[model samples]
Every structure is written in structure tokens, then in C-alpha cells.
Target: MNASRLTDHTGYWMRMVSNAVSQEFARKVAGQDVTVAEWSFMRALYDLEPVPPSVLAEKMGMTKGAISKLAERLLAKGLVVRTENKDDKRAHSLSLTNEGRDKIPVLAALADENDAEFFDTLTREEHETLNRILKILAERRGLDATPVD
Candidate 1:
């Protein structure tokens, strides 16, 4: 029986880089009064306004409870609004408030900056290859959940 070293697995390295990238992005967004999870939720609603909570949950690959919690927070922050469904009074829809719409471009800029800060060291070809490989692995593994943490 042979034991493999920690460095023997590509997953270990991937996780290390992923953690660094996510943490820095989290920190950046924190200054903007939002979490990465909130940013994801806002980004999703940026173009698709007035979507149902259930639809958002499905698109984000999150549970309804999770989406509801985030929505509540955003609502309190005046970044999102909820309205009764016109067709179904029993259901409700969510959309970004004017403030949310304004903040999205700033948040998106932070995301772009975070990616550059970490991945700019890689050559263009290396970056493209890495993105391709990661996408393939994610698809193959059926890992569709948005990274909120």
C-alpha cells in the first residue's frame, strides 16, 4: 500500500489558488457593503430583472431558503426590491433597485481587478488553457453551483 503525498493531487493545488482568488475578491467586495454571495445574486439580476425568487434559486443553483436570505439582506440594503407576482398573487418576484443597478458596475470592476491581480502572472495562452480545462472539469463533474463563499 502506497500513500500519495498531498502535492500528488492537482485538486490540492487548484484549491489553494481558488482560495486565494476567492478570499481577495471577498475582501474587495466587503468594502462595498456586500458579500461575494450577494454580488453573485446581484449580477444574476443585473440583466434579468423582475425574476421570481424560485427562478433565481434555480439559476444560481442555490436553495430557495438561501436565495430568500440573500434577498432579505439586499432588500434591507436597498439594493433589491420584491413585488407581488402579477399573474400569481401567491408568488413574488425580485429585482434590483436603482442603487443595486448603480453598484453592479462597480462590483463588476472589482471582479475584473481581482482576476487580474491573481491571474495576470500567467501568459495569455496559459490563462486560456486553464479556463478551458476548469470549465471542462466543472461540466464533467456537474458542478453548477455558483461559488458564493
Candidate 2:
């Protein structure tokens, strides 16, 4: 029987580039003492200051349990703080600590560097076109979730 080679698929090619890009970024963030998921969570929380984990979970398209887990990790690292709701003893909200707020730009810079490492080979026009195509694909596919993995 004849078989199609793996490299004949566009997904295979995309994955080859994606895995290398992702692995390098993972290494970059590891040096900053945060996982990619944590970075994503922190970046989300940065925008929704003092928000409940439930809200964060919704915004991130993540489970509440997942949000809680990320919150726990961030809290342990002193990068986030959880505050009890005044009206409800069992309810709480999460927010970035001063240190975490400070780290956002630094982490963002690392993300920029990572993108450059992988995509700088593309001409500026090519890069913009690639971004437009990816965005269109993402929108059409309803792939709206924040990419944590």
C-alpha cells in the first residue's frame, strides 16, 4: 500500500515550526521562573485587576479549577495576591502584586524576543501578512481561547 509522507501535510510543517518556537519560548520563560501557562494567566490578570478567579477562568476560557491552580502558583511565588471579598467570607479576588506588575513588561519583552527569534527571518510585509492570515483563520475557526498550552 502507498502512504502519504508526513511532510506532505501542512500541519506537519506547522508543527515542526511551532514545536521549536514553543520549546525555545518555554526555556526563555523558565529562566524567569514562570511557566508559559503562568505567564498567560498573569497577563490576563493584569488586565482584569482584582478579579475573581471565576471571572478570570471565564475570560481565559479555562476551568475555575485551572484558574485556582494558576492562582495558587502565582501566590506562592509572591507574584499575585488574593483578597477576600468584603461581602462574602468564602469569596476572594486575585490581583498581581507589585512585583508581578513589574514583571509583566519584562515577560512581554521576552515574548517579543521569542517571536523575533522564530519569525525575524520573514520580511516585515511577510510578517504582517502571516499575522493577518493567522488571525483570520483563528476567527473563522472560533479559536477564541487564550493559548495556555
Q: For residues 17-107, write the lDDT of model 2, one tens digit per residue.
A: 8889888999999999999999999999999989999999999999999999999999999999999998999999999999999999999
Alpha-carbon RMSD, each predicted model: 1.1, 1.0
| Model 1 spans > 4 angstroms off | none
Global local distance difference test of model 1: 0.95
Q: State the TM-score for model 1.
A: 0.95
Off by over 4 Å in 2: none
How far off is residue 70 in model 2, in Å? Answer: 0.8
Candidate 1 local lDDT, 22-125, one digit each (tens): 99999999999999999999999887889999999999899999999999999999999999977889999899999999999999999999999999999999
In the predicted model 1, the residue pairs found to clash are: none
Please report the candidate that would top TM-score against the real structure.
2
